[model samples]
Target: MGPSSQSATVTASLDQLETVAAQLFPAWLPGAEGIATTAGGGLAAVRSLAIAHAAGTAQYSPFLVDLAVGALAGAGPNTRRHPPEMRAAGLARVIAAALGRPGCALLLRPPDDLDENEALALVRAAQWLVDHGRLAVWISSGSPAPGDLLPEAGIARPAGTTAAGRPGPKVHSTVRGTVRCGRTTDDHYPGERQPGKSRRAGRHGKPHPASRTETLLEAALATRPWAVGRAWNHTLSPGPLVNPVRVDLLWKRERCVVELDGDDHRSAGKYADDRQRDVLLQLDGYAVLRFTNAQVHDDIENVLALLQQFLATRRRTRKGH
Candidate 1:
């Protein structure tokens, strides 16, 4: 075959592979009897049976071998192979889709002839998919070990039941909880009034405790700027009737607050709310500093410098006053 013809053949095979994966993913690996038991015995059932038949006929299934080779091929004059980074990204998106819907499945076969870096990238992507749970991965030829890929991720092909011995639920449940820090109950902030011990006893009591992000900011301050335990809770003026807003990280002495903006803050409504909060803080004679997770993770030094600079200015202003 000419180079053009070979490339077209490879691309066509990949299209077939994608179609097969889409068809078989929803049914999972229920055997022949299970397929019949399912409503309609559907397209997925037929595809699954076809794949099984193809696999048993040959040691290396020609049906999927071409697709796997094409997936691992490097960029060439007439090749449709995706770059390593792009391949990993595409796989991640597929895995996410599979996870979002129950009974969705995918099979990735990496060619054994891949270079070290290519193999490593594929392995990492596979590892990530398996780590997220529910998604079962099978590495037929180029696997590091027989079952090592599945063991660490607690994933097994043709999974009869979930790790907990129950049928896999469609949606994964997430539990959110608060992390309490500091010493024993006696170790309270200087101004923070304990529930019953404080002289200023009232129905409302002190504002909500500092969040985990605030706790980290406090620790970071202790290392730099030397502002340890300086954060104080300052409730929004005219006070909220319900679930009153409170600054995340505050330095009462300097009248500076640091707000850790998370992913939710990027939403239009939340972004507007954030701007309002900043305006309120500014109007209340306080400097509000905002930092996103990316800034903290990617540019820690700069974030710390900005915070330090804000604190210094606030402190100097307080001293001048």
Candidate 2:
């Protein structure tokens, strides 16, 4: 009932945790990439948060456990109730399962009925994992009171917005485990088979440099100050609707996606898949634009012009909304 001694300890809401999670992955965090919280249960929330954090990549597998449930059920016979120490140990085992894999982070949600002592036990378990340095832990709670062991983290804010206009409370300090965004390069693309300067197989088998088309398109995209991210072979969604297909280019801030069609795209299956992806992206509220590799090389000026107009319109639309 008294004021908690741990009140000054920082706590991150689900929103803050989501921002931190998004930055950890190599995908764009803006636009539809934001995590959506479910209305159902904490398990749903944790899973959704993990998906959003992974940014449509197969990089993360979120493991969820309710400590309170495990404590009540008891891990061993002859005991129906687990003490805080036992509960913490149970949580540790669960956390260990998520470790040893690259790019994997754990999202742990405490049981709803946890008391102060139990919550602290859970916090200690999470802290121990964080200190180990292999796995990252995100604690999700529907309503976290002060003194909960949620350490403060800096949430990425929308650019140029003042504090008063910003939604939710503001934390000026930088987040503890924030990952900064970098320019997307060819090496970062997942599953890119060719490495630096390897020649094999056929006339086209050499690890060639950037094509003229790719160069022109990247140059044009670079001129646009409004586009926060311009990534090739950018994976859109690793979820059920669209997975395994990578976008030719992505503009995160404007939510505009562009795909450069090559000879392969004209085939029956590829064309159909392209159309399906466009439709799915449109339904997800992104503006989809398609251009040919020829268009990129031959008529790049016009292509840039078109993208400029689209980016402007999208920005205005976002501001209006």
Candidate 3:
């Protein structure tokens, strides 16, 4: 395929993947109101064992518990000594962390050699996660039948893409750094303009205007001598299977991230997503600094001073280590 065709294909596949994800997870829906509760007193969740080729390739089932525990407690011994409930809770927490919300759908791919008893165990485990952890568990296609143990959910795998290989929307690199899917180059730091290159256009071919608050902060940072080596709208991937997040500003050498929050961030969903992003970034050893739009607009000088302090602190800490 030609470059444009390949890009278009990838974009379409990503859209399809998102559609599947949204169908499975209510929280992923646009304007979703937190985690929904069912009339029967259960958390609104997807409990079916989804049978699909993508699930088999993803292989998140076997190490689900381990990944969860490791994420929470750091690298350590096996969690075999932990109770089943504890393990389930840990798994749920990690999955929630990865997806940025509790009760988000989880796709599990059972091992190829899974027996009927093992399949039953998997179903029971998924049930525990749904009941106690409030997670939507989708067991991927192709496991041995567990005898009516789980409600069936169908997921049509996208052609030529495995679950693991599914692409997200393209993130384009700027003169200074890469911009993730949701942001545009007009959001780039004010002072980092590339020589002879026009301002990068947004998806609609017009520049996405930066918020006044962002522009004010960017302008101030541009004049500050200490604000060197910062990249705006940079992407950071926390770990495997997790979507990359774009920070408003990043100083990679100092492992510092700054987020400029607008009114949209006050929503319950965005608040939860921000918290999750912060947790993941912290786990990856980056210090996250969050500033609201009002803060930057009203107290530009103080914001700059505080940011300088934090950046300096991070640099010192890194040097000390």
TM-scores for the candidates: 0.32, 0.35, 0.38
Task: State the lDDT at 171 in candidate 1.
Answer: 17
Model 2: per-residue Cα lDDT over 1-321, one tens digit each: 111222211122222322332223212222223333323453344444445644554232332122211212232121114333332232333322222212223344344455555555545444543333223344434322111221222223222212255333221212322111111233222232222322122112111134445556666667778555556656567235345545666776666666554454445555444544543454344555666555566667766766676666666666877
Q: All models: lDDT?
A: 0.39, 0.39, 0.43
Q: How far off is residue 235 in model 3, in Å?
A: 0.8
Tens digits of lDDT, candidate 1, 96-176: 333433222233434436454444444344344333322333333421221221122222333222235542211111110
lDDT of 3 by residue, 193-284 (tens): 23333333222211124445555666788899998887776778965545787676788887777776544444555545565565456445
Quick one: ranking by TM-score, best first?
A: 3, 2, 1
Q: Which candidate ranks first by TM-score, i.e. highest?
A: 3
Q: Which of 1 and 2 is ahead in lDDT?
A: 2
Highest lDDT: which candidate?
3
Q: Which of the predicted structures, 1 or 3, would earn the higher lDDT when compared with the native?
A: 3
Residue 261 of model 3 has an lDDT of 55
User: In candidate 3, how many Å is residue 264 off?
Assistant: 1.9
Off by over 4 Å in 2: 1-209, 238-244
- lDDT at position 149, candidate 3: 18
Clashes of each: 1, 1, 2
